[model samples]
Target: MKLTVCSSVLLLLLTFSFCHGGNIFVFPAEGSHWINMDILLQALHSRGHNITILRSTRSWYIKANASYYNALSMPVEKSIDETFITNLMKAGVQFVLGTTPWLSSINILTKMVDIITYLHSAVCELVSAVLDDAALMKTLEDTKFDLVLSDPCWGGGVILAKYMKLPLVYYVRWQIGEDAHFGIAPSPLSYIPVTGSGFTDRMTFLQRVKNMILYLVTYIQNDVISGRLYQPTCAKYLGPDCDFNQIKTDADIWLMRTDFVFDYPRPTMPNVVYIGGFQCKPAKPLPEHLEEFVQSSGEHGVVIMPMGTFVSELPDDMANGIAAALAKLPQKVIWRYKGKRPASVGNNTLVVDWMPQNDLLGHPKIKLFVAHGGTNGVHEAIYHGVPVAGLPMYFDQYDNLLRLQERGGAKIVSISTVDKDDSFLEAMQEVLTDPSYRENMQRLSRLHRDQPVEPMDKALFWIEFVMRHKGAAHLKAQSYNMSWFTYHSVDVVLFLTAAVLLVLLTSFMFIRCLFRALCKRKVKRE
Candidate 1:
């Protein structure tokens, strides 16, 4: 009887704890954002919080299991068609890396604007599709979730959170984007480089001016152009009273996928949390075949090349050139190639459809990582202390590579310039032979690993903290309410300029009157 009473007391305590934990609703967009969200969702689930995932499709990273409170897969057939996504990805590659031959003749800026228009339309359609789903919308409303987590990249998350009256949290993957302007973080136009500008924090006078112009252009594109596109859809779904401006500023917390160890030190708002390398996991033992290949390399070591999931297939000439370059190296190469096998691949090279990239990089035998400088790849390389030979493509890849190059751990080679066998080989040789590259990477790895809490834990803690505090409104920066002019003190500058002009004008008038009086007195004396 006494043992039964003790068990009842334990059960009561467990139930009380469960009740206190908040219910989190997660909405992950397609691609890498979905993959990143899987990690955070798993962490949150493990911490006893109930997690309900509302995804467009099944994620390869997220398994269907009992750990999650609920998993809802909504069809987005009318929203995201395959052809549109294909064209969008193609346009992106062409705009940034100049992949398509015919596209090379077209004006790059025009192509970029067209691509942005399509992407904006796609996002709007997605929002419409979600809001149109009566069952899904009703289900979401009935859940009465404590908080909503999503990547602001999609923009729909912000709308959903506001509509549901829940605290919104952003899972930002790229360091540079519209999130900076939304008051979630501070992205100074003077120093901090714009997303695709490819400039470093330390910029020359001319570069700083260029960066400032780029910032203005991006702001217009995102806020003015894209905002207009989003307004109608938001109004349609969220009612006419809904404002896009409110959605931009309503985020309660920003979980930025960056850290000072990899990115340059920049000012961030209190609500902004840095959880870089959150996706990086402990090294798992390589498969037998991979282990054998690594062992065969002996002292020369191995190089792992992956262009990420999106850019799986490379241009034939580029692939052949890269294969030929690696063939000459002493090190064995394991490349993730989705296209037809290259004829230039030597006995030392093994091209496969996929690779356990992070695990392979963690292996002690890994000497180099050749990639397109995606955030995940870059952070994984940093986590594993592997130097990079970066061939940056669209979006933040160029900026990521530039930062890695600045940090002395990477060699950036333009995709246009990489067709030459000698140049490609020379770039690879420099990274492999240079002692500074390895040393820098090793130092960064140490620093990245020396955090007070693991990145995943930090993310989980902050997410729950926000939920427990009921939106954590205290963390919002005062700057959130300020306009661009007020935030940067542009208004202050204008005010001071006006005051100075008024004083100067008054002085000029007083002197003119005095001179006129003196002339009148002189004429009377005459």
Candidate 2:
């Protein structure tokens, strides 16, 4: 009887342990972005998986926006905190890593179990943009990642993955190179042409060419720099004999969070999966005050003017221009102004510090969106079938707005042009009253929302897929080895032809010398 009782108790304990799945650790560079990851964690937890987030000891936002003079007040990046380890123990994270830039103490966790690092942004700046700190490179080497997932930020991670002999997957969070974007002109490259303040025009032909040249140079530079960064790191960790490029393509997948509908580009490889809208979820209802405000707008609907988080302060002239434009519009306008509101507030105008964004866009009375063309904002606008008037600031916003325009759902106005009352009014009029824009947005919305799976679920599915397959190598890009000139085989063929020409030229020169000598000998004999 005692033996049977002991056996029963042991079986119960085993069942209890199995019920709680192993740990998953997350490190986020941006605090606000934690929400999206949190959603993913919640879903996993509901499925009986335990997870924990290891936030930066300090905040990325604070570093990004703090006054220059006060910058010294910012906390220096430190070794991993003990709190992170404590949380790891509680959550049972058998696997760990987050958006690259792992904390220095990450090695402590890696010593405990395997690590999976997710690259959200391509480290494009690491090559020529930022100082290549050797000590940082050594730290990356010490992590000994089992798998690396890359997003568009394309720098250090790509190279690290190569050197580490770890599986790599390049995943794009937004549409890469599309032929013609909706709101802007098209480019062959996946990203938009980056424009700086030095440019005289909004976009110049020379600027485009420069951008194209930079694109290729960046790709080559990325590979070379990545190779340099990782080769040494891998040698230190995994020994000197690591086959840096031997990481299989199947082991690395180029997963894009874009659907075929958003980008009409044909898939070149099975590994390059166009899974757009992977993070989208059904938007919930707005707060009572917000809902009432939308209901008050009546049939014409409300125009949502949100410039996004990066640029909350609008110039006085720009604010005045927007207010002037809103006054003329028949629809009620809810402007999410971060700074002071304009003195010329119209009867239909409503200014708030921060509005519930997703909820506001999802409101039935919210017809048109005035955005700064951020990707997240664009995605939210598309998910809600709302047409946008984009004043793209910089980065992917230019390209994102272009795609939205290409879909016929959005319009772009230069801040310089719309900084005046007349232009802002004209642009707002076009977006708000135009039936074509509405139709286009609705059409695209159907495509984005009609996906078989929700974005969060798909993200979790891919995350789990990586865990299950030990690394989805099939999706990695093959262009890693195929250098621009080599990939096209132009340099190799050209080199061979050059060699042949050189050989022919040398033989001709030798014959000429021999012929001259023979003529001289004959003359001497005579």
Candidate 3:
């Protein structure tokens, strides 16, 4: 009787959840970006929501068939894959390896631009395919999704949401090659450093000058590319006057993948909800082999290098040098690498193709993290309170690691000098031996966990909040539709300046006339 009663209760609960569930449409980017998106989709599915993901026929990471969500593919000629990543890594490596200033700057000119330029061009192709498909558009419209959830890293989703006329929510940290905040918020360049500048919030006069120049570079880049690449798509599908940047900022909610614990304090908007470490959860038990390996360390703890999935292998020489360095450590090392075995690798180290990164990081025996400084990795480190010895590969890695270093939870080693000298080894030793690094990271972990609601729950609440209301227009800023002249109050400034100048000129003319009249009266009297 009790068993039947429990079963009936479970069925009723499931029915209730299903009845209240929403239907969501998701447009996601590939690579590590998809990983977190997938996590959120899983949670939404568990809550009994129906999810449909839009993808490219050429997508390498995004799966067509998944239990959590249904997928709709847009056929396209070009796609992003490991080849792009390998080439990008090569260019980035060359850029860092360049000894001469001209050589380094040339890499910046040639391949540095290739990173975003190529990615966006491919994205534009997919966007074109999706819009050109009238049948697909009809199907999407008929479905009548509650909202469009997207990663604005690729601008295609933003354009799609505009076309569908649905509420838009962003699972975002970046937009194109720059941080998304610059597109929406009031960022004072004097203190708020631009993305990829590798500078902190506090800056000297010279640094601020550098900051302004970089900000202009980003502005020019955004304008040139939007006009050249995305404007045509918008003109065709989203109407002639529909500005792409305006559509980007018009997003109803920004589920920002950062919080104050992991990021420096800065200006924010009412619609931007910070959900840093939302992907993180308490550790689960490790696989038997991994647990046994971890236990073998005994009195000494383990050091894990949890590099994200981009790197399959490293150059043999560089690998050997890293292995040699690790060989000297007293602690055991578990490296996640798919490359050929290095000759100098120590007996203390175990390298594998994959790892339960969060599970291992949360282990009591795990002491240090050798990281590549991806956003997910950084957040996981903070969540698990593991000190990092960062090997920043490329893109925003340096900037991400620098934030933690400023907080005294991590130390960065130059990738260029890592293989050449003892820098990598020394960095590892410092983070491992110094208690301050661990203590600081633990403190951050406590602060992150002390919040009333979990970041992930907060993210879900806001997403549902949009769905319930049809949109969050009240929270959105009106600046998106404002022209540059109007948004910055440039016209108002010009008018004010003109008024001040007019008043000063009038006073000057009156004084000159009075003086001249006084002189004439004096002469006549004489």
- Best of the two (1, 3) by lDDT: 3
- Candidate 3 residue-wise lDDT, 8-61, digit = tens: 999999888656688899988888899998999999888878999888776878
Best by TM-score: 3
- Model 1 clash count equals 0
lDDT for model 1: 0.77
Each prediction's whole-model lDDT (CA): 0.77, 0.55, 0.87
Residue 243 C-alpha lDDT in model 2 = 34
Model 3 segments more than 4 A misplaced: 1-19, 99-109, 308-313
lDDT of 2 by residue, 1-526 (tens): 9999999999999888756343332322232333343444566666555443323334333232222111112222432233433333322222211213455346545543321121212122222121245664464456443355443232334444554455655444421222212111223433344322112123467776776676566445434543554445445444586533333222345555556555444325545555465555567888788778888887888998876343334456656766777878888888877666677769998888788788788777888899986656777787888899987654456667777787798888766555444776787788887899989988888878776777656665666666557676465445544534775689889999999999999999999999999999999999
What local lDDT does model 1 show for residue 153? 72
Best by lDDT: 3
> What tens digits encode model 1's per-residue C-alpha lDDT throughout 17-105?
66666789876666666667777777777777789876545234434454565876555543444455556666666565555465563
**How many backbone clashes are present in model 3?**
0
Per-residue lDDT value at 466 in model 1: 79
